[model samples]
Target: MNPAEGAGSLSAAVQAGLEGTGLASLSAGVRRLMDAYRSGEVPAAPVLTSAREVAAYAAYRMPATAAATGAAFAQMRRGLPGWTPATVLDFGAGTGGASWAVADQLPDAAGLTLLEQSGEAIRLGQAILAESTSGALRGAAWRRWRLELSDAAERAAVQDSADLAVAAYVLGELTERQQDRLTELVTGAAPAVLLLEPGTPAGHRRILAARARLLAAGYDVVAPCPHQLGCPLEVPGDWCHFAARLQRSATHRRVKGADLPYEDEKFSYVAAARPGVGSPDCPAGRVVRRPGQRKNLVTLDLCDRDGRATKLAVGKSKGEAYRRARKTSWGDRWDDAATG
Candidate 1:
């Protein structure tokens, strides 16, 4: 995948829906609410409260979140090329951004079950779906249900879960133990599970814990990791992350107080296939960091199929592979074909 992908440009229909919501004046206030969320001030409550907060979060975070998640989906595609998911179960589906991303990846997605604690977010999601042109998304079940790590009833209700499940940016709020429990809950709910978090030490830590549990449960990693081996980059001040850039609209700029035309969403994610699923075919390895290009050679750091890091230097004299290395960006699946 490109280090930066364009996946979540706001649709005209969505923009029009927001306009019809008559909540345009609340954008600035919602931006402040987002600031609170970033600071972790709004812990133990819904990040989105009123309709305006929902609109603000949808405008300010949806595009970047969708773009990042879409990149992760692309990686999953590379890993599990033959698997096709017909249904999606979204936990903590705020504004339904991740659900929309799922529909984008699988146009044939026939069922969507979204459970969120915030009624406000669910309402806004309904509005967005009402204006959607996709038949699959047009008919969705977005509900207001609290997702507790210890709620057996909730887990039981998800027993009749879908083929794919996603939990995006919602795990950082829990304790490590709760995160571990939630991992089992998520995997139990679907055959394929995707967990994404912000690109931070805390976020990466949560993903690492989830990865350990998924592996312990005999799950095979589909993307990001070439093999089921333990992550080798355990050094301090370093965390595995990928980046995706999305175009921001004028309303998005005003809500977030930004002047840049585009923003890069840095994220850490893990995508795993369940027990019956087979291991992914890794022709070479995955690009763990951005490739560095210089005069006569390019330096590529790869996490090989066994999940160990190897740094390779390819000079121009090496031929076509070297030429292709120059174009290999971050978050890409590099193979022997590119390693002459």
Candidate 2:
């Protein structure tokens, strides 16, 4: 499905979940949730404690989450064309935003499992997904599993094998040890893994760390990074991130008390797959920043397969290369062939 259709479907599903709910209470809950997220401290308990909070979260944050997740999935598809996972496992899935993204991006994913600690989130997720037309989403299994579990057997039982595993906007909520454990669990369960975090220095650091672990575990880099070597942006105060712009609905605006018709969800992500599972046709370079244009020249900042970050200027003299550069946006794959 196209982005507009996917957004419309998600908005409809959220509205279905919020039917008969009080908008005043939901708006207040959204403010509280936003404050909690901005505080940068993991709450002592599940954030979606009450049914109202879950609804508030679904109405407020789910769209942006879906947008960001979809952007990451698009990059993954570019890296591995024609690859589709039959099964998907989402860790800390919350109200299933990532699942919705998968349905839109990889429609052939037949089986989906969503693991979350909040009972309210699980129930609300089920309700939201039930409104979806996609059979894969409607048939998804919502399991209440805590990532902090210490028992090996309990952890193993919850770690069902799948073709792709996702942990989106949840890693920062765990302790260092818990993060390590969750990484190991997901890596063991799936041949491919996708990790997403807020587009902040800390978030980029988490993704970098996770990328290192995946590489050590014999996984190959798939998206965002063009090479398996160390990230060149690892220098202090410099980090890699991208933005996904999403149009906001009327209800979304009311819940967030914002007047903007759209918002850009900045996020950092890493997609990697086990050696043989990754594509050999990964792009030679990825546009790392917004392209700068002036007169007849367009300049691009890219992370290339050579494991280096560099800038290239395409001018009108370059003919087709200049046309391609003019149309390229941030987070797009850049091919050297375009210049040749």
Candidate 3:
């Protein structure tokens, strides 16, 4: 569904909140902060430092972030349909965008705990949630705490044992040691964890690092990649990311100064569940790139369960497979049942 056509209740509430506030007041600050984030620099302090900044960010970035997060979670559901999470732990929940994504996907999720450092962000998120029709989000616990990977006590406040734990766009600011510590803490707390980053090369590397750590800790891989083996994207000059296209609402376009009706949010993510918990079965591989179509042939690049990348060609003479291939968009999956 297009985000503009069907925004989650929390997102709608966020938009309403931004509209009530002077959203344009902090537009310049939001643009500057976003540029820094795009450049891969994690600031030491909160980017949204005031009501205006928080509102500006909510108006400008929330839709795209929520859309990207929902796409990642959809992949997780495809891989683990049997895994129904009752609770979620959102780390660094800026205006609770990711939490809203979780709520949109996991309708039965009755609990939410958001850990964030900035009081301003927390207040804005609470305001949005209060305005939301979603009972889960409205009832969520907004915990104001700094993220400290070095301190065990502090890390414990990150909701150590939720059914699902999410860290969206939060790892880039930390050092390697901090990342490792954060991973250890999260893995210890939750049986299932989802980590998301920007679509940049650095973001994919972060996902790879988390994947390795999770696998070593006895977690099973789910979504995007079908196998637990080392990533095949190790070749130089290559990275793995997925794109999610979201429709831009009028306010969203105005805030971001984007004239396009739709924007594609690119993200790299890893979702994994521990050994005892069973996940649903999905396709053995995913179509990582857009299928190229010619007069009669559809060509695709696939990432397989064996941790290999291979190209496949389906001609018009190929019957049903070709017909199916013609319908696939990027970030879609297919298996032997359909193509072999």
Candidate 4:
């Protein structure tokens, strides 16, 4: 699919919804609140939203994030040793929406644990999992999935229980103290953890803090190079926004209704793994095509390294379209310029 073309509609809808949300007006205040809480100058609780709002947000963003997360996990899967454990955990698993992100990719994983803190959230997640028709998690003989309602206190008990742990857009909700506690739990429970966050500045800050703590604890850096560089923005703000579009099944569209949007948001994320007997060896950066070209030529440039690159020319397209003046003299000049 041509992201440039399809993205316009998705972008317009997202922009409209975001504008209606008054988030632009609240961002500065939210950032201030987050900063104050981070510095211990103020105490703040996790910002709560309506169930509908959470569902809308998840429905709009899950497809893209899940696809990207799955791809990243697939890349890392190549580097894992045969002896890597078969069980996995989804820590801070909200409604278990994200387990679908990596579920199919790690088919060999025998046990799947969804560790959530809220009984309500776990129930919602369990309901969703039970309704899936793909049988992705149910058919495999080694598969065993369960939702466990617990907090940081249970971390040590399940320490080293999982080969992989995922915290998708969960860390930003915690206070500094809680973030630290959860970080410790993740580092101890699993050898590799994919920490996903919203593409917003506040989300980035949370991940940045967690990255520091994880690195300090000796976790090996995988994708997303510059595991150490600070934010580059002269003045901080949201850096990037991405979207993922998938064809909705008839039943899905009917159940969700046309009023509910189908496009998904693609926020930025980083996948980190532990040292030895771990994920694929690679760096992370955006894939792009060559200059003055319209074809679908793809390349993955590793970040944090010098100006190094690897390229692959995948598909081709016709030359760009244009219009010229009717005048013969002007047309002649235009033709000459085109030839030149």
Question: How many residue pairs of model 3 clash at the backbone?
Answer: 0
Ranked by lDDT, the better of candidates 1 and 3 is 3
Instruction: Give all TM-scores, in the order shown.
Output: 0.91, 0.95, 0.93, 0.59
lDDT tens digits by residue: candidate 2, 1-340: 3344353489888888888888898998899999889988867777887988988989989989889999998888778865788899999999999989988776677899999989999998999999888889999998888875467875677555788999999888877777777888888889889999999888898888888888888888899999998898889888999999988877888989899888999999999888777454677788999999999999999999999999999999999999999999999999868874
Model 1 TM-score? 0.91
lDDT digits (tens) for residues 237-305 of candidate 1:
888888887877766677667899788898999999875654456557878788898998888888888
What lDDT score goes with residue 184 in model 3? 78
Candidate 1 residue pairs that clash: none
- Model 1 spans > 4 angstroms off: 1-9, 20-24, 40-42
Q: How close is candidate 4 to the true structure, as a TM-score?
A: 0.59
Error of 1 at 258 (Å): 1.8
> Residue 217, candidate 1: how far off, in angstroms?
1.5
Give the per-residue lDDT digits (tens) of candidate 3, residues 286-323: 88877899998899888898889888898988788888
Q: How displaced is residue 80 in candidate 2, in Å?
A: 1.3
Model 4, 61-161: lDDT tens digits are 43445655565455445334343446667776655545665775555556677776555445445544554432543332222222233564475566887
- Each model's total of backbone clashes: 0, 0, 0, 1
